[model samples]
Target: MKKTKIIEIKGLCVRYNNISILKDIDLDIEEGAFLAIIGPNGAGKSTLIKAILGLIKGYKGQIRIMGTPLSSFKDWDMIGYVPQKAAHIDRIFPITAYEVVGLGLKRGIRGNNAARYINNVLSRVGMEGYADKKVYNMSGGEQQKIFIAKAIVNNPRILFLDEPTTGVDIKAQDAFYELLKSLNIEGMTIVMVTHDIAIVNKYVRQVACLNKTLIFHGDHDEFCSSQNAIELLMGEHHLIAHRH
Candidate 1:
């Protein structure tokens, strides 16, 4: 039995003003797959995700989420997104961690049910005990976990994370990846955009290298073994057994 495709992109193209951001992009994400989109800065990786999320307008080509065209897909709740650092979060805002996660619950899960749902997600990320903690007091990693809890509080089938470990410490990053791996094992589709090469080789099952177009898209091992990937990502240096 073949796996179902959770996301499908065909001939996708995006432009801002008059310059092209992405051109002729094609990719597929299978159900339960952990896909990492990696590339140098300004490579249109973020643009691709925004296009799929319908955050960008006037994009050419097709994007389908769970077999439904982007324009026709009405199941926004089924998809969850954890943006980098919750970029707009004001550290001094004085909101509780639970309240932050609660914002993800746009509909349903009211009252006790809502609290229970939020608690469950927080617990999954190992931040349950900090439910009442002020967001500003938490470390960068702790705050990132809170963001993850918020993204998953709604029980989304597919989760998208952008630069999830950007400011996290090494220990916190390890724990974070473990949580994500557990979620993927339990049947959640994960699409993460990152510049972290180490985590890419360790956690993601699929790799998609983008530089205004699809440079490579296949298994992790295949990507690691490819000369093109090594050149594009690691520069002129050969990939050593361990990257310091």
Candidate 2:
């Protein structure tokens, strides 16, 4: 059986000040699929994400989520997002990791249920012991995990992460990818924008390459074999791989 598409974009074009960033993008994302949007900087990758999130208006084309037009979905509570860069928070803000996670339950909190939800999310990210620690004192990876917990605390159906592993250590990157994969296995639709082809091949089931254009979108092996991908990444960027 063909899986139902959770996201559909047709003839999508985004422009800023008369400059086109994304051109004629048409794609479909199936439910529970892990899609990695891979491209170099200035690829209009971020613009595409913003368009899907409805953060950018006045774009020409159609975007639909879960069989409904993007504009029609007034309640976006089902979508969870993690930005590319973590914002700087005050060191002395007087907030604990638990409190940070608890913010995800901003809609409503009844009794100790909010606390339990926070604890469960933190435990999922392997930050069970750091719930009481100040956010400033925690390492970058730990802080990222906290943010992940915050994103998933509400049990969103679709999770969008932009460079979730950026600036983290190798071990942390591996663990973070594993966490995302586990969530994907548990029936979460994940759409992530990343420049890491190696990680994308390892963790994501599908890959899409963009460079102000939709170059290719398909399986990992096909992506690696595409001439367009090679020209975009290796030809223009001068990236070389030594094979014995």
Candidate 3:
């Protein structure tokens, strides 16, 4: 049986101040698929994500989620977003790890069940014991895990991460990837924008290459093996040497 499409984008174009950033982009992401969008800097990768998240308002395209038009999906609660940085969070916010995770339940904060959900999400991310610790005191990797816990606290069906593993140590990167794999296994569709080609090739089921255009979107094996994809993402010099 074919999986239902979770995300559908067609003729997507993004522009800023009359300058084009993304042109004629189109993509269809399957339900429960782990997808990675990869490209070199200035490839409009971030712009693409912003467009999908509805952060960029003047985009020209049709975007749909779960068979409903983007405009119709009023309850964004179905989507979980973990930005590249915890931008709004203050280093010394005086909030514990548990409270941070609980923020994920923003829309469901009517009663005590929000706390229970926070605990469950923290445990899933293996940060159960750190619930009482202060966010500012934790290491970078730990902070990232806490953010992930917060993102999933609402049990969203679709999760989007932007440069999730950036600035983390090697060990932390591996652990985070493992955790993402586990989450994917548990049936959450993941859309990640990352520059880590090796990790993307190893784990992502699909790849979408963006650079002011929809260069390619398909199976991971084909993307990793394609000459064009390699050149587009790694640059022509690296691709030539990599193939040789």
Better of 1 and 2 by TM-score: 1
The clash numbers for all candidates, in the given order, read 0, 0, 0
Candidate 3 residue 105 Cα shift, in angstroms, is 0.4
Model 1 lDDT tens row, 174-229: 99999999989989999999988878867888889999999999988888777677
lDDT of predicted model 1: 0.87
Residue-level error in angstroms, candidate 2, position 27? 1.2
92: Cα error in model 1, Å: 4.5
Q: Give a tens-digit lDDT track for model 2, residues 1-244.
A: 9998999999999999999999999999899989999788888888898899999989999999998999888657678788787534588687889888887764767568888888889999999999999987887888889888988888888998888877789998999999999999999999999877677668888778888889998876677677887788884444323222
* RMSD versus native structure for model 2: 2.5
Clashing pairs in 2: none
TM-score result, candidate 2: 0.92
- For all candidates in order, the CA lDDT equals 0.87, 0.85, 0.83
Q: Give the residue spans of candidate 2 off by over 4 A.
A: 235-244
lDDT of 3: 0.83
Candidate 1's C-alpha runs over 4 A off are: 236-244
TM-score of each: 0.94, 0.92, 0.92
Best by lDDT: 1
